[model samples]
Target: MAESDDASDSILPEPIRSVTPLTGPHPDAEMDVIGWGIFLGLMLLLVPLLPFIIVVWLISKLVEALTPS
Candidate 1:
């Protein structure tokens, strides 16, 4: 069992084995701000539109299913 575990660990990539948690400030604060701003803006704009999008998609799929191929 120990030999099998060692073999599995050896097969993993070096970066996967050496992973570490972030312990310092973000490398680029400006980029972080811009990224978060864009993410939030999209969420705000898309959440309300989601229901309509889903309704449209379902209607299209229903029409496709009902029509002869």
Candidate 2:
């Protein structure tokens, strides 16, 4: 029983550990610029669609208003 316990303990591998610390907080220019450009482009595209969304919303509201509660 003693030998079996020791054998089992030896067979199991040790737990893995890792630690990653930030070395710097500087923003990456290329990634930041690309991300911002994509974000701005999306916003620009969405802005033009705002009026269409408002029209749809208004139509739905008007329909609901015309219908009985």
Candidate 3:
């Protein structure tokens, strides 16, 4: 089992070594833009609603506490 594990580890690095490193704008650039866009969009949409959401959550918690479960 230990020998098999060592063989597998050696083989794994072979594939990694064969792969050419990417050159150019990072492959994640587009994803970064999309992720940031989603984050900013959510912030814009949620910021105004935050107070209302908090108020509703507080009311629910208050009611839950006051009511006999």
Candidate 4:
């Protein structure tokens, strides 16, 4: 038992363990404010534009109906 203990201690000079987890992208990653702004702005624009888009589509359909196939 003593010899086994000595062998194990000699085999590893220092304890090989990590106190903190390996640094990963999730921990180091940063948010992109410009990207967020662009996407948010586009979403805001889309909400207002959606009604106009539908109205234009309806008008186009009406025009199409007035014309021959």
Candidate 5:
């Protein structure tokens, strides 16, 4: 038992652990502001692109429908 205990202690010099988790948003106001800004920018950019995409898709469908098969 004593030899086994010494061998285990020698194999590991110290216990490895973390006191805190390394995930999730930081509890900071700046990070929240940046996140909201990025979200809003994405929404604004996508909103304009969506209608143009829809218009182009509708025009293609209209052309396909009008074409004689």
Candidate 6:
């Protein structure tokens, strides 16, 4: 029974382990450029939100005008 269990365990295969040694942070130029691109893309994504902001502001003004302090 013990032999069968051992054989099954071996047949299942162990999880792969990293062979490379752990090193400190590695900052490369290409990675830096990619990071900048992602940042720019995020900022550009805000362009579509402008109309929503204006609509909300206009609604608030309309509500204030109708409520009469």
lDDT of each residue in 1-69, candidate 5, tens digit only: 999999987895676889987897558898889999999999999998998999999999999999999
Each model's TM-score? 0.62, 0.55, 0.60, 0.46, 0.42, 0.39
Model 6, span 1-69: residue lDDT tens: 999999988796678889998899886999899999999898799778879989999999999999967
Q: Which stretches of candidate 3 lie over 4 Å from their true place?
A: 1-27
lDDT of 4 by residue, 1-69 (tens): 999999987785677898988975563224577678889999998999999999999999999999987
Q: lDDT of all predictions, in order shown?
A: 0.92, 0.92, 0.90, 0.85, 0.92, 0.89
- Once fitted onto the true fold, the runs of candidate 4 whose alpha carbons sit more than 4 angstroms away are 1-31
**Would you list the clashing residue pairs of candidate 2?**
none
lDDT comparing candidate 6 with the true structure: 0.89
- Which residue segments of model 6 deviate by more than 4 Å? 10-24, 51-69
Candidate 3 all-Cα RMSD: 5.2
Regions more than 4 Å wrong, model 1? 1-26
Poorest stretch of ten by lDDT in candidate 4: 23-32
Model 5, residue 7: distance off in Å is: 6.6
Candidate 3 is scored at a TM of 0.60
Minimal lDDT window, size 10, model 1: 12-21
lDDT of 2 by residue, 19-63 (tens): 976477786899989999999999999999999999999999999
Judging by TM-score, tell me the better candidate of 4 and 5. 4
